[model samples]
Target: MYWRTREELSLENRLRRSYYELLRDELDQFIMAHALKESYENFKNNNVAYPFVERKELKPRARIPKDEFSLHNSFLVIFVEDTIPQAYKKYIRFFDVNKTTKTNLLRSKTLSLGPDFDRSQKFLDSVHFYHFLKELLPVDYALLIQRDTSHAKTKHRYYLSHFHVRIDWPISEAAEDLARYLRYISKDVYEKGEKYAEDVQKKFFEYHALPDMIGGRRTAASVAAQYLRRLPFISTVYVSSSESRSLYRYCEQGVSRMVLMRLTTGEMEQVADRNNMPVRELKRFYMLDQNGRGGIFLFRVTYGHTAPAMPPEDGKLREIKPELFWITVKYQHLLPLPGIWEHPPLRVNLIYT
Candidate 1:
């Protein structure tokens, strides 16, 4: 028998188990309500079973894992697999380097403008606005295509639009990883000072930070909790790099304060195990509040896909897809004592599922 220590058992795994348990019962009721068993028997005897619902070996690629650990952190695999068309593969490779280089240079120049520059403020404002709009739009991917035709006598144009597509996986890890990649790419642009660096920064910032800014830290936690409540079996939400800073700061102030004042070493270890990280490792600190309500906050947000708006129609019901993005929050607490202190167990109270 495989035995998992309490610390080894991830919250995501537990949640996945819970989710499946719930889903199994629901599926059974659905089968019973539709007389699926009887219908299946009849079809087997009469050769009338609908092919759509017939049991078939699921292709390995078609199935999604119910637990978070099995989920890939980044959507690169799926994006390369699903969204990239066969015809564009060559073109994508050709433009990959130059496009990346240009985007990086642009970002660096904008950030170089010192903190007080109007251009920087405008850049931040634009980022916030885009994020606001993103919340209203539902999209799976945003593609950016740029082509230049000046080389040919006929002025043939070649352009490639960057595509930002949503990862359909329900696991937060997928989104978190995607967000981190976006930020990493943007940071490169920030360093390079490319022509489109400003635009890239705006987009990256919007995709990763706007949600928390709009709703506040508490609201973000609530959102995460709601996802947890939906588990039919076992599921766990993994906070990404993007979310770590803010959430850690928030939790330290809100919950860690209480825990640190009273909890013993054994209790602290238990909490660390529950969080799936070592107690000592979690004790490092980064940010500090003036009042010392929370100390040592180190967090970063990762960016994922932000969908573009759809064309409007006169009569048809227009469905706007919610912009799907993911963020991960990581934190290490610092105590006023001689040594740093780890955060206590967090009891996230979800508002509405």
Candidate 2:
């Protein structure tokens, strides 16, 4: 995720991408909607519904909507509950004046008025608001509005840019080819029912965008993509949840975290169906071991391919297969990425279909 300004590539109009950030915010919502729909019978009006912000002016107003309309914008939520509940109490202070001194040590404070005060000028009601939003975002627009991450960027206008990725030495075709083949084999190991399937759907089904392609700036999807920029640029194929926890523990032992990345969002949206006090904001970060230079740097090179890679001898290998790259790191490599294989999605041509 940490890169010099020049290393980043332009995916579309403005956003650059890394492999980890597979799903965009809108697509995340769409995927959540579809995922929840499968088990809608168990959901309740309160369990899934929440207030959503529609406008930002004086005392912003929010519209409460159904469960589907309230899904959080997170591409990755399986390992952890992407949504967090936070409470904030707002108060207006009133100072009491003393009769003699005209000053007071005590003050009275009261909670402010509840949200649901005003409506967006664009919509008549919550139903109308969501209907308008749903219609405004066509399925095709949501899917094709931008592109997904890819190693080859020039050919695919929508593919995420990746020149920032660094490797210590020259890469070979055999290594790349073997990686693809192994990734194919590993599919059976990862196909662990619902969780794996959902991740696959998001990895392949959802669309990705360069920050600029959407708003000339980085969005949640574009930022989430940075997680791939960590020491291990390779896919998390070999590392299970427990393995990753171990890596974190190791990183914590005396490895002074130098904030290599920081993400900030100006907007906040209500996160729950209850009082609309605690809202969600999009933020991401990358903490590098500033201490790594003195200890040692381990270049964890693994043959990683998410999709099958064709042989370079094949005419369309480059077109259909993913390219190989290195993910050098600051400390001893964690989670053995078997030298056998690991990678990212194919170019847009085969990916979307």
Q: List TM-scores for all candidates, in order.
A: 0.18, 0.18
RMSD of each: 26.1, 24.9
Instruction: Please write out the lDDT profile of model 1 over residues 207-280, one tens digit for every residue.
Output: 33332223222223223322222222222121211112111111101111111122335544554576676756
Could you tell me the lDDT of residue 133 within candidate 2? 30
Candidate achieving the largest lDDT = 1
TM-score of 2: 0.18
Cα-based lDDT for every prediction: 0.27, 0.20
